[model samples]
Target: MTELKKQISASLRKDLEAGELILPSLPEVAMKIQEEVKKKSSTAHSIAKVIMLDPGLTAHFLKVANSPLYRTQNSVQGLPEAIGLIGINSVLNMALTYTMRTMFVNTEGPWKKVLIHQWNEATELAAIVAVLADYLPNFNSDHMMVAAMLQNIGALPLINHLQHFPGLEQEEVETLVEENATKAGLALVKLWGLGKSFEDVIKARHDWMYESTPELDTTDLITIARYHYMKDKQRLEDCPPTSEIAAFRHLEELDFTAEMSMQWIDSAREKIRAIKRMLCM
Candidate 1:
């Protein structure tokens, strides 16, 4: 590693070791949505009211509710209708995804370009994962999409920190992220009090060898989505063949062949495009 790389890595390590890393927190609207979701007595209208407070989130929620992902017969006309159609859990997840995405929109720095690229890649993977969830059992497409979007979230703070070091090249910062993102991400997730699912998925997202009793879990779905993203970007050499991964191995029980996976994604190209547009990517 170069001197700059060493400095970046050491600083991150010291922070992590000392539990002083400044992780990002969820937006207030997202927190309110989560609080509403947790209240067993909360009604759809109540959640809708919280969502409506943020006009941008309200618009995105309505757009996603009417998108091909939900496939509602009629367009969702308002926040209440959108909540009723998409469910409180899904609305909470969408709101979180939207809010987390806004945190990455840096406008006046060299890091802005890198942050934009990362956000686009994240949204793309998220869309693909949401579509792919339709094929799996007991999986919430919206929730999985949110998880996929957050897979590399640890990199955001690290990249933000790198802005202070002018001599560090983008490549070096990316390399550091590749090596330490999971650790940083887990810390962030824990700090935010996200559920165990978020913690598990973020912790094991990059571990191709991860296996669970059910064989098919959020981590597996994320791995598959990530594999497709890398393959589409011609970065396959950096990862193993999708079929060789533990998640893919378990998915084989469902007779999920590589060709089938590709065909499914190919068929949903238009849907994916629609989701990206709704996400403002």
Candidate 2:
């Protein structure tokens, strides 16, 4: 590693150890939606009231509600209607995902481009996970989607830290991020109070062989989604065949055959395009 990278890595490790890293805060709108969803009495209308506080999120919600992913025949022209169509939990997940996008927006330097690339990959993986989750009986698609989006979030601060130094190659920075993102990501997830399951997902995402005692979980879903993302990007050397991937093997219980996996990726391509368009807007 370069001296600058060494310094940045050390600093990041120190901050993570001491709980001093300035992790991104959950947007107020997401906080409100999260709080509202936890209550038994909460309804779509109540969540819609909270969502209205953020006009951008409200607009995005409407767009997503009418997206092909939702398959809503009627246009969702209002927040209440959008929320009602998408469900309370889904609204909460979408709002949180939408709000989190702001954290990756950097205005200056090549890092902005890097952030955009990372964000794009994250969203694609999340979209695939959301679709795959639907075929599994007990999986929570919304939560899996959110977890996929966040799996690489730790790379943001690390990349930002590296930007302060001169004479560093983008490849070097990316290598550092791939090495350290999980630790930083888990810490950030805990700091955001997103829950232990999410933290586990972040920590376990790179573990292809990870299998939950009871059944498949977010880690398995993300592993498979990431493999597809790599394959879609034509990173053939980086991705193994479906049969060789542990997540695919563990997915046998869900009747996830190799042919079905291919079909899932083919179907997800369109949804991923639509989702990326909506989120990027």
Candidate 3:
């Protein structure tokens, strides 16, 4: 690593060790839904019932269902209709994604804009990952979709902390932001008691291969998700020179090639437009 990257990483480790990062309390509804899902007794319908109570969430869910990205039977008028259109797992993922988006909106200043751009990039890549995962053999697109949606969550608390600490220069602070976001995100997944597999996906996002052993599918989704985020060049940078991306780059080893990748890129653009139109983004 370059001296600057090493310095930033070391500093982030110290700050994280000192507990200076200001990780957000998980959204209440997301917590509730997670708790309900963990209750082996809870049915999808039960979870769906609770989610319907949040009008903003409910409206967003319906809007997502009606988006041109999803070919639905018809316009969804209610929570059940929306859930039916997208399936239980998809609804769950969408709820979590939407909740995360709301939290990012609560930040202010340059960091707020930076994080918003990151979230938007993540969402776009996630949508493409979701679409491609559907076609990739042995892939669980649902898990991939949710994981991709949340991969950058580590950055939020780091930015929050930067805002609270006024002494750092903008450029220097941004380096810390990247390092801590990765570290804090990994820490939050562990602190929040997510599945080991989920934790592995978040932590190994830049790795060359999926170390969690679930399947290479979800890792591929994360790979592309991060790639698209980096491609935006506003919130982040060009894709990291890491083994994880190289693994994704070897898609030509599969039936797919560089040319085919463009389809995903194009589809993601269209999906973003459709979502923006629906949500007035």
TM-score of each: 0.94, 0.90, 0.79
Ranking by lDDT: 1, 2, 3
Model 3 TM-score on a 0 to 1 scale: 0.79
The runs of at least 3 residues in candidate 2 whose Cα sits more than 4 Å from the true structure, single-residue gaps closed, are: 106-110, 240-244
lDDT of 3: 0.66
210-268 per-residue lDDT for model 3 (tens digits): 44543355655577555655555554344554333554555655767544665776656
Clashes of each: 0, 0, 4
lDDT of 1 by residue, 1-281 (tens): 79878977888889877877777777888888888899999988988888888898888888888887786667788788888888876877888777777787743466666767767888898888988898778999889888987777887777777778878787876777777778888888888788888888887766877764567788888888888888889998889876678888777878787677778899998988888777744
Q: Which residue pairs in candidate 3 collide?
A: 154-185, 207-244, 208-243, 208-244
Task: Rank the models by TM-score, top first.
Answer: 1, 2, 3
Candidate maximizing lDDT: 1
Better of 1 and 2 by lDDT: 1
Clashing pairs in 1: none
What is each predicted model's overall lDDT from 0 to 1? Answer: 0.80, 0.76, 0.66
